[model samples]
Target chain A: MIVHSASIEAINKDIHPGMVVADATATLPALKVYNYKEGVCEKLLAELADWAFRFTPVIAVEAPDRLLMDISGCPHLWGGEEQYLADVVAKLKQRGYHANAAIADTIGAAWAAVCYGRPGQIIPPGGQQTALSSWPPAALRLSPLILDRMHRLGFYKIGSFINMPGTVLRRRFGQQLLTRIGQALGTMPEQLTSVLPAVIFQERLPCLEPIRTRTGIDIALKTLLEALSKRLLKESKGLRKAIFKGYRLDGNIQQIDIGTNRPVRNVAHLLQLFSQKIETIRPALGIELFILEAPVVEDLSAQQESLWTALGDSDANTELSNLLDRIAGKVGSAAIRRYLPAEHYWPERSMKISHSISEKPDTLWRVDRPRPICLLEQPEKIEVTVPVPDYPPMLFIYKGLIHKVKKQTGLNVLNANGGWISKRRSGITTALKTNRVRGIGYSGRVNMTKETLNGIYMDFLHDSYEAV
Target chain B: MGQATEIQENVVERLRQEILAMQGLRVPLENELRDTGLGIINNAFPNQTFPVAATHEFISDNAQNGAASSGFMAALLRILMCKGSCLWVSTRCRIFPPALKAFGISPDQMIFIDARTSKDALWIIEEGLKCQTLAAVVGEVQELGFTESRRLQLAVETSRVTGLIHRYGSLPTNVTCVSRWRITPVASIGEPTIPGVGFPGWNVELLKIRNGKPGRWQVAWNPDGFKVVQQPKVIEHLPARKTG
Candidate 1:
């Protein structure tokens, strides 16, 4: 591959950019090579702009390693403009970067001086013409084709065309060439778009010394929480999730996080949530700094504390979500569940466990059919004694207890007492209809067939009918 | 002597009233939340009304007893659930939500918290009991000690939410629950000479109650609520006297 960039050491060896890497390595067998990506230069320039924020609040990043800072009145903070420029360049060099900076009356002049004139040069107002005349025509930031055409026309440097009339130069080399010169000489104004960070919800507490005790950490967390909640309360917003981080003196970060089902800004409740997880953090050496970040926030319209605190049905729902949140934090969210009705015939599939506490059921729970309050997880097999043909069981054995069946459906028979005693088919049963129970018993042996018995037989959840 | 005996009776009556008051057993009004469909059984309570925000225990001998207690608890929870939800915390719950509809309680209004361990279930139950937002908390555990039951009582006292504990064993006399009950499924009798298992009926026995009398009642389930079934009037027929 061809060379993309060359260091000062490589340039001193006459290894200019655009030369093949094979030729350069042949010249110096000890040369090191690395691959270059497209956006590396822009990324580095943006980071440099961020670092330069200490110098000026208004800083803009230009592509391909350029930064524009509006230092009109900011230089006095650092002694003077020259020292400021030296300090900036020196700092960049100390970080292993070769940097050139210039201060001029206009942005275009400053850019041209940094690119073409001597390094660390400061130009007086209206002196860009004298300083830039000796540099090449390309220093005006013109296209390569325009520079090639100017070179072919015997114009090698800015001084060659410095005294030419603008109209004549525009006609010969096009308007772009004259426009660049005018912009550099301060004949035109320019706009600089500054980058400023947006406000974030974060609070920090830097301790005077390393804090090693649990009380110290607790105090730090409380202070940060108070500040954060105050700001959130003022903004009519609340935090749904938050993280607390401690910067330990041993260079380790101890972090704990908490989440809420609903938006909450109450410091007391949030502190209680953190208290459940506070013991998990080991403060080892000591904590030097603490930071709390609200990663998730939501809008909760403000209401008076007394109004919400008053007992009401709506407030009960709110308090319930908070209570569930606290319980979930202790035993995980999976341990808690709400149920909704599912339109299924099987009892197991008739209801489903719901994760959301406030979800509405699609199908109504069937009240027409009777269902058992406590269904056996597994079907239980018991012993039954059928007294006669086409008749309900007379006695059943469940859990080794002889529970004599009291109700008989059809074919009424007398017990030893002979009082027209019928083993009552479970009357008012959750599984049977009232009329069906009456019809089977009062109709007198007409519907006592095997098929009808199986219908009542299938309702195992109703009672100990499985024994029958 | 008669006058002295009258004075002693007056003092004893006053002492009883004082004890009832200290137990927080003031009689509730007729139109309040004390209507638990218990009929005459409600009078057996200390205040002649069903207690709310108090701990009740149900002891079961086996699976049949367990099911009966669950049904009875669900019936009570139905009355307590007034636009509020109930938490059924247990190791593994087998109650069918759709079946709760028969008790006049919509299944969607109930939350089931299944814990992997009985201890976790107890913790969840205590937490739910302490939350004033819930209507009631039903905990089905294998066992609970005297101190644990006392802790649960304290939680309900502050939150004013009822707590129901179900266990498959003998009752604990030293527990701090306000009342203890045992329910057994009784054979159902059809209405008006119709034969079959009519409404699901149970033999509800209040074994012990604080500052109240223990009694037994036969209750049957209806879509509306509990119906107290009267004892059957069985007239004895004279055995034939002509054996000689």
Candidate 2:
């Protein structure tokens, strides 16, 4: 096994990584070693990142051993950059880790200062060039092959070619060397993705007095909503769902939430929606805190309101949403339904209920087929008496009234692959047309005096083509 | 003697205008008049025009009537929606949304709000009426007192939205509405041997109306439009087809 990593004492003995374990053992017979486990470096870096959150909200973890933090506005809290850098490195060392930190304007410059320059160095802003000039070409974060080539060319230090003409350096060392120098010198932009996944839109309001009355609760809710909506509007986002919670003095938490059919940021409309549920929130014994959180937000394009459609249409659209929001606030939002056509033969599955106003049907509603105006939630079992086979029931009784089968229609059974086919799949057609049709899906359109029952299904237990 | 009769007729016309104005009804000019496509039924409404901005109550006393009233109102809403959105509020929405397509109204445009109680349904309906954006609001309620309906009427006055209250299985209350109607199921006329449920027909009865005739008519509704099943008094009601 090779030495993956070695302590400073082993390094002093010239035992470096990639050296055979036996050679390292010979150099120091008392050398210690441990088995290498996968992903240990990454786990340690993540824990360090979690600790780094106390310093700055904007921080990223570059895998293996680098913690990049933008401390442009963060160091002042610890008095100055020197103390901040010292405290950071000192605190990490106190955690039984040998940590070095460097503060600079650019990520590359700071990385170079931390890795190659003196420990706990603080390079002045915009002075990355002078600070990095003393370091070696390895400080520029170049590949090992390029560093070896530079070493062979007798350009060990970066200052050896600091003032070299751009074309000359480009021809000799290639474009990668120039790009690394450019990145360190802040000539090109680099991105730092934050540790936090997404921004949380939340607002808190602590009441000066414990609000006991409904009016007081309403005021608190409105105040929090206004502040939250302002932040949402500035970001060009709207919340589809939001929660309002009140922390009571008695340690009881009362919470109410509102959901919009679509994303909304309008304060007045949101207030109106919340007003409907204010009565349900019992501020029992008084409440001390109120919080509004919007967990589900979506980009509400501001241009879409003005760029397309006529002026009256967009206005009416918002007004309609506002109106629906109020209704949803009063009744549960589930009660509100809008249906789109679905391409299915079973009546219950024929339509899809949509919640949003902007949803459009993918399939056109079939007008050729007749549907009932009022559909029964469940089909009532009717008593039918048949005298012979292959004929419709002679008479049927429903709801205490007997319906005489003067004119009878054919029975239709729908298969998923095949469209409506005849009832030839039923072996008992001679005995009873609806012998075992109970609780199965079949389309049997009944023509009665006033109402029609449609979308009935019949499956045969004894026939070979049961599905058909 | 002829001058005296003209003076009396002018006085009657002035009084009619005053009453309509007090009720917050807008008098449409000749070009602004909208045809409800109800054929002669408009003859039974004030100013010979179906009040699109007013509340119309439909009383259904039986199961069939409940279904028929919804079907009949769906036809009216199709014409009155003016390509705008609609709201249907109820305790439990029984009107099959797909069935609205049969009446030429797209089901997607109709939002059904299910309330836990009839009181809540009416409240939602009143709030819906106050919004000027909606073209129509249909509330399925079992009962509504006179005071509650007046609030609904007041809501529509500020916003020119048509409100249809389909109250099922309840005694009719004295509501200060523009009109009251009872739509009963009429056995659909079809070929007996064809074995089909046939076309939907309603025996539409105008039980009450102010400043107009109260009449009943048999009307059959289809996607194309309404066909007056039995045209009433062709010779006597000739003026209605023109004025309405």
Candidate 3:
């Protein structure tokens, strides 16, 4: 077994990490040791990074045991840089954590200052060179090999190489050493990858005491929304979507989100939408913080407001969309749909559903002829008894019910493609079109009449044909 | 003492008569019928027009009957839904949305809610009826009892929105609807020169109307509006089949 880490007291007794456990025990018979568990340090670092978000919006976790925060413009809010650094170190100390914090113009310089200079050091802007001159070469955060090489070359202190020419150093030890020197002296730029993207249109409310009631949550949400809406109004923008997140005392977060059909700046309307979904958030433990964030925002100029009332079409469209949102809140978002007319002859394919209400159809519905108010989902098959060639059915049975036809009207012949070919055709021509006949239109009323009427119609047709 | 008592009674009777006259004047103005654009069919109601801000029940015995009822309801909705959208809550929607175009009601003007059960459908319908923003609420359920119908009526009473309940495959019973209707498909009439089917026709039966006489009419939908068809009398001299 090997010793992975040791405390300060163990180090004082000549016990160090990477030493054989047997030897360490022999050196100090009562030395306490623990087996190292993998990934424990990484997990703790991630947790610390999350906690550090309360201090600044930008936080980057440096592995093993470090966190970098860029509190450039944020420190003034906490009463200046010195007090801000002191406040952070004090808070960590209160939490039983030993931490060192430093502020400088560059990341490398700040890291070096925090590691070697003092517990709390504030390096002035453009003062990295002078501040880092007296530190040891190891304080530059170079690799162990580079530090050892520099020590062997009699460059134990950073001041020893502070005045050296870059060209000479580059020729002697390659570009790495020069680059390290440049980075530590603020000549090189460095970038930090934040743990999460900063949300600009966000407001946070931290409670002095944990709140556990629904009314408390409602009040907190209202306050945050008010503040956020004020900021949005000042910027002349509106949010399309907003999320409310509550941080509980037990380290759990509950969030509820709401979306609007248009960019909304009204807090009351937003609160109404949120009220519908706020019950889903289970506040098992007491909540200590509430945050309202708008990740999706749009530029809402004043001119858009004028267009809303200037045109009647736009007014009705907005009203319809608002109604849809309210109904969706009750039923669901998928329950509502809008359709646009499509260019098709088939009844079912004549119109298509639109994804949103704002879309306009290219073609209007065909109103040339009157269509049925309700078309059967599927055409029902009927048994019809008709005369041989071109006469309408005298009797038909549909859905197990027999109907005697007393009168028949317009005869619309549908072609195979579902298009109406002609309204009326001769009996012989209708026989030819029967092969391609897709549908028949037999719309009329049924009445009980004497059989003598049928004979007269037959006689009349015979007389007309003979005269022609 | 008898004279004083008689004087008090006379004053009370005078006040009562004045109030009755005022109520008589207000009733005609407030309960005026809304023209449904159907000529004689509208006259069949109590006020010679269709009922507005009231609940109407339509019974469908089968799929074909359901189709006919929905079509008739769509035609009524075309006139009612001039300013607001409509809510349609159904257990399973069997009516094709595009078919409503024939009645001049666009699919965009209606929002459909597909509920999981008849109970949920009724709840949604009641909630929709309470919303004044909607012009009308249509619920299609297999069965709706008296209590549920009364609750729906009460909701509409407050919101003043019309409610059309299409009951399918259920026997009609006692309910508090303003009126009840049953529509069945009838043999259509077309000109001999016109080969296609003529306009849609229905045998509209007003089974029960509150404070109005019950009647039946043969109505057909024209492009403009509903036209009442005149029934021809029997004449022995005519042929077995009459062609016009």
Candidate 4:
């Protein structure tokens, strides 16, 4: 293809001149020369489809960098037909590529003209050969092997190749050579398939006057949300998350992105979520135009009605979640936490913070086992003066106060695995051992057995404890 | 032995059934007491109607005995139970459970949370009022600022949950609360004609109510529980003789 050859020349400076480069051009026959087989013709076709919409919708990509446009009516707007072609070439050059443009009635004629015709030649409806007479045989985009064979057959150029016997050409270079010759002459009607354009969803809100204050920005955000919500509804879609871009006249842009727990179109709910997050958007020299674009959207499908669904009663879960959101917004989120049940029945380790979303599965609260309503933040170390082993201590010293045990209750059971380990006592076994060592006497070790952990009691001997 | 186990199981089953049967029996007793003005309507609110929107405050001195704190809660709860449920976020276990039950507040209707310190207690009470389900929220806390009290007042105005703040110990005089009620325990009477002998009696004084007259009233909280009675209008009274 001419694009391959043109791109090769364009990238020659960057490529080492003497390197033995494999001509991947054959592997991707229609790929641009500079692309070096990295991109397929299909992907290039899509890119061209998106880019060439500026010129005309009737454009279709011919193999390689070639584009065929039925610009039968839409050319004079960009100055004139010749100027428009020049404008397209200039734009392509600006996008880091050199391109050649030509216009013709049939796609084959246009392809041949751009690849082989003289510079700035507009081939008439029926003039294909006369238009391509002076072009080289390689301009037909035929295999180099076939072109070399044509040269050997005394056909140095396409004009001379056309005069050669058609049977001789097919017999020598196979049928593909004769087809390419016919295609260049506009006799074969070479098909140029078009690609569908990608769907793009975007909504823009231009502020009537430049918004600078917090109130002004909030008002503008409401307007942007309304426009975006309407567009999403019309498209039968809802956004999972949206990006609010504040484009300032000074060229700096600030983007504030907010995500919702569920698909939502309710303006008030969305406003409340964003009101907590809009502070993250640094106004940045004040915004003039606001654009809300949703990159993540899905079809709005109805949930299957369930026979067991509660219809009239209000959903308590939603009310709880909204209450949590409000509390988290006012007081820091760290201050609010919902109690979650743990597998083990230990009092201290039985609860953890639940996630903000309500969809997460939770463990059921168990009522049979008695859990202490008040858990001492730290299990204070007590010095037992009573005889150890099987008996509960009659008196123990805690915080320097000797409290006598009024009652001795024991819950005897085997120590289970995965029990609650309080954070303060990281090495619990060692801490328990240390308590035994520091206890009343050397005989205290006998009382520190795991079997004796059922219950220990103490009462205050005196009100002698002072603030530490 | 097997028959004894079966009998015990039957007894447990019968008790559960009895409890269920008695759930609706309180309506008549409450009505009769309401007619006599001796139930929660009389004991808690002598004003005849329930204290709905306005804030009721109790400021305690914690003097001679810790009566002001406990008595204020007992009286306040009695009034709150007249309307329905009352929420008590207890800082210290300063609330006497038996006293509140004597005032006709079923233990089930009153929810109690024993927090470690006074600060944690107010936080729970504040959070409870925001729920708007409680008829009255009572907290026995040491201190509450003007701004914090205003926040509670505002939440109560919107939710209609009566805010009853009972200060635990004595606070400085300048400290402002919505309304203040001081409670003190006097000697108990033996009988209708007899002098004084039995359990501790409570002297309920409405030191402050937003739109109502503040006055001291005599009430005997004997072993038979609290009973409102007429007493001579005097600032100080003679100590009743102890009867053996």
lDDT, candidates in the order shown: 0.73, 0.76, 0.70, 0.54
Query: Distance (Å) between predicted and true CA of A89, model 4?
Result: 49
Clashing pairs in 4: A403-A458, A403-A459, A403-A460, A404-A459
Candidate 2: clashing residue pairs, number: 6
lDDT for each residue of candidate 4 in B131-235, tens digit (9 for 90 to 100): 544557777677777666766666665666667776746573422343456656553434545421233345666654332344577665432345667542333
Q: Per-candidate TM vs. native?
A: 0.58, 0.67, 0.56, 0.42
Superposed Cα deviation of residue B218, candidate 4 (Å): 19
Query: TM-score of chain B, candidate 4?
Result: 0.63
**Candidate 2: regions farther than 4 A off:** A1-196, A212-216, A284-286, A304-311, A385-394, A405-411, A415-422, A427-431, A434-439, A442-468, B1-11, B29-32, B190-197, B233-244
Fraction of native contacts in model 4? 0.00
DockQ of each: 0.32, 0.37, 0.15, 0.04
Residue-level lDDT of model 1, residues A51-146, one tens digit each, is 888898888888877899888898788899989999989998988998899999888789988988788999987899998888889888888989
Candidate 4 or 1, higher lDDT: 1
Off by over 4 Å in 4: A1-203, A206-209, A231-245, A249-264, A276-284, A291-312, A315-320, A332-334, A356-364, A368-370, A412-468, B1-42, B45-143, B162-244
Question: Considering every candidate listed, which one attains the maximal TM-score?
Answer: 2
lDDT of candidate model 3 versus the reference = 0.70
Interface root mean square deviation per prediction: 7.0, 6.0, 8.8, 14.7
C-alpha lDDT of residue B199 in model 2? 66
Candidate 4 global CA lDDT score: 0.54
In model 1, the number of clashes is: 18
Task: List model 3 lDDT by residue over B1-244, tens digit each.
Answer: 9999999999986775565333221122353345677676665555565766678999988655676778778878888888577888888775556556777787767777777688878887887788766789898998888899889878877777789999989899777777788877654544657644456666678776664455777777766777778542222342233110
Where is model 3 more than 4 Å wrong at Cα?
Answer: A1-200, A299-319, A368-468, B1-33, B130-133, B145-147, B230-244
Give RMSD to native, each candidate: 21.3, 17.0, 20.9, 21.8
